[model samples]
Every structure is written in C-alpha cells, then in structure tokens.
Target: MTNINDNHVDDHSNIISRIGKCIKQWFIQDFDQNSGELDAAFKNNMLVVATLIVAVTFQTGINPPGGAWQDTKVEPGGHEAGKAILASLHLPYNLFLILNTLAFSMSTQIILMLVYNKKLYFEVVVATVSMVATYGMAVWSLSPDKDVKLRYVFMAALFPYVWRLSFQTFKTFFINYPTK
Candidate 1:
C-alpha cells in the first residue's frame, strides 16, 4: 500500500509539471507557434501599402480643392458640397482627416520596421508627425484667402514626406539601440 501511494504522488507531480510548462510556453516564449500564427495574420507590409494608398488618394482627390500647384478658393457652395459628401459617408471631415493622417503615419512606421526586421520607437514618430500634421491642418483650416489656402494646400501635400521622415528617424534610432 505504501508503494502504491508513492506511484500516485509521482503521477500527480508529473501532471503539474506538464501544466506549468504549457503555461510558460503560452506566456513567456518570445516566438512560439501562437506568435507565428499571429504574425502570419498581420503581414505588416501589405497593411502599410494599402493604408498608404488609401490615405494618399483620400488626401489628394477629396480633401484639397486641387493639387498644390494651382491656387484656388473654396467656394461657399463647394464647402456645402463637401459637407454633404461627408455626411453621406457618415464622417466628420476634420475628424476623418486626422485619423487618416495617423493611420498613414503608423502604417508607414510599421512597414519600415517589418522591412528592416527591427523594433521602432513609437513616441518620437508620433510626436513629430502629430506636430507637423496639426500645424498643416491648422493652416489649411484657418486660411481666409486663396493664396493662404494655396500655401496650406501645399503643406497638406507635404504630409507624406513628413511621415516618411519620422519613420526614417525612428529607424535610425531603432538600428542604433534596439529594444531587447
């Protein structure tokens, strides 16, 4: 009877060890099977390219009156028309504009990290792009004359470049001092 009890205790100990191992694998492992599944689902490069294209098309085709090269006034009727369009799409144009800028910037950074197989510093990129985009939007939103509007329009055109620069800066920092 004593020998039988010892065998039962050993079996229980083995089961507990197995469970502990599973838990560690699930939570502590850096690149496990589950992580591989997630990585496959969220292919960063595709997301970045698609989002960038959408942002560029939305900004260039809809947001501004025209390309940066031409000076144009936003007519009262045109503003009304734009508002109508936004209403039809169930979006506030200004809010959508901000979200689009953020999404594009984030996607660009993610793509750069994926391409280089490195981690990026998020705060710096976010701070720089937010500042630039906010200033650009302010100039665009507050302008009262066609020439001033033209300058804002050009500023808007520079958003993509600003985003790229932020990513480049982050990439440099990441390469120099990678986390972990």
Candidate 2:
C-alpha cells in the first residue's frame, strides 16, 4: 500500500511538472521582452480586421469574375453554388481555404490571449461574423435575379468593412493600453 501511494504521488508530481512546463512555454517564456507595440485588445482587433480584409479581397478578386455570377444547378441548394464558386477559383478543393480562415481566427485569439495573459472571449464573435459573411455571399450567388445578385456583390464587398468596423468598436471598448 505504501509503495502504491508513493507511485501515485510521483505520477501526480510528474503531471504537475509537465503542466507547468507547458504553461511556461505557452504563456511565460520570452513574453515580457517580446511583447508587441500594441496591447492584447488592439492586437486582437487588428488581426480580426486584417483577416476580414484578406478574405474579402480573395473572395471578390477570385470568385465570379467580371460581374458574371454563376447559378447553381441544384434548386434551393447553395452547396452547388458554393462548389461552383470554389471551382471558378481554379484552386485545389483541399482544406486550405478553411484552414486559412480558421488560422486567421485563431491567430487573433492567440494574440489577444498573449496580450492579456488570459483566454480571449471574442472567438465566437469572429466566427459569427465569418459565417454570416459566407452565408450572405452564398445566398447572393444563388439568387435568380440580377438585382439581387448585384446586391449580394455589394454585401460581399462590404463584408470586410463590417468586420473592420466591429473590430474597431471592440478595440475602442477594451484597448485601454496604448501602443508604445
């Protein structure tokens, strides 16, 4: 019984040590000297806005060229439209785009977490914005009329701007630490 208890204590100690090491690696080591010019809130805001800009640019420049929107073959199904949009880009149908978008969102969260030394709370906000933007574009692409299509184009164009504005508002609210 004594030996078993000792082993259990040793295992617990090892687990604690490993957790400490991970925390140090993730949140503490090189943190003070490597802190960026902006605070956590500002960095998060900047990342969100920058990602939106990049996404908007890519979507507009690559998909539906020359204002010629493509219609979906399947009725009431936007998946075909989404696939067509992806096909028009001539890019591989791999997870690159999805991963890229996720990376952008995570990068913002990580930056904010590092800045504040705490977990970020705005990941849901970023994700919601992205989803809404994507859905809006998909719906517009599948629209049966030119006017609605044009309206979607305009909405897609403004998607990034909306995200930017939202990020700006977030920054204004929480970015109390000024840039050095």
Candidate 3:
C-alpha cells in the first residue's frame, strides 16, 4: 500500500524526470542546427573587442578627453583654452581617472575570460557596457554641455534590457556553441 507521502514524492520525481527529458530532447533536437562557424565567430569577435578596449584605454589615458596635458591653461595666441590638469582633483581629472581605471579593469577581465576559455557571454556584455559607461564619463568631462541629469536617466532606462539581453545572450551563446 502506497502512503500519501510516497505518492507525493513519486509525483515530484516524475515532474523532475519529465523536465530533464525535455531538456535533453531539446538539446539533441537543436544540436545539429548549430554550426562550427558560430563558435569561431564568437571567439573572433571577443578577441577583437578585447583588443579594441585595451587600445582605447591606452589612447584615452595618453590623449585624454579635452586634449593632452598642457603646462599652461591658455593657448599661446589666446585662442583655445589649454587643458591643464586641474588645480585640485576636480570633476574632469577625477572623472577621467575613475573611467580610465574602470575601462582598464573591465577590459582586463574580458581578456582573462577569453584566455581562460571561459565562454560566459554575460560577463563580456557587462564588461562592454562598463566600457560604454567609462567612455560616457569621458565624454561628459570633455563636452561643455549642461544636460548631466538627462544622460544619467537615459542610461538607467536602457540598463534593464541590457541586463536581460546579456543573460539571454549568455544562454544562446552556450546553446549555439559547437561541441567537441
């Protein structure tokens, strides 16, 4: 005689078995649709992106936003204002420093992920988005525009979809990945 507890346990086991079989079947059914080229493309694209971020980080530090460092605050002919390092650690320099560090860190993480054969697409997307934010800070420092709050609001608005897509992309990349 099966007790009620036994029936409950059996029901749970059945549900788990069904879910596992469905997952296995789905993978098996769709495995053939994925091609080797897709994996290679993801790898190649990651390499390109990592290299670009490193390059951009170096360039941003060397050239800077407003311009390269200048000894004088004003140009020789009183034309354009020179971009001297600020008197204190003010917005421009502080922002640049923060962004530069963040960009470097994110890019380095991406590189490490690639080198370690870690195919986590969410990490890559997040690092890319961080780089975007870093560049946005850099741009804010350079531009004389006055719409600070709007940019923050816009970035906040776009972040949810970015995160969701990052997770979705991570799953898809794994699914579409060519298995050896």
Q: How many pairs collide in each candidate, listed in order? A: 0, 0, 0
lDDT of every predicted structure (CA atoms): 0.48, 0.47, 0.55
| Model 3 pairs whose backbones collide | none
- TM-score of every candidate: 0.30, 0.30, 0.36
The best-first sequence of candidates by TM-score reads 3, 2, 1
Q: What is the lDDT of residue 55 in candidate 2?
A: 59
Q: What is the TM-score (0 to 1) of candidate 1? A: 0.30
State the local distance difference test value for candidate 2: 0.47
lDDT per residue as tens, model 1, 58-77: 45333443322223336653
**Top lDDT prediction, candidate number:** 3
Q: What residue runs in model 3 are displaced by over 4 Å at the alpha carbon? A: 1-38, 72-89, 117-180
Please write out the lDDT profile of model 2 over residues 4-39, one tens digit for every residue: 889999999999988866744443323234443556
What lDDT is reached at residue 151 by model 3? Answer: 47
Q: How many collisions between residues are there in candidate 2?
A: 0
Q: Which TM-score value belongs to model 2? A: 0.30
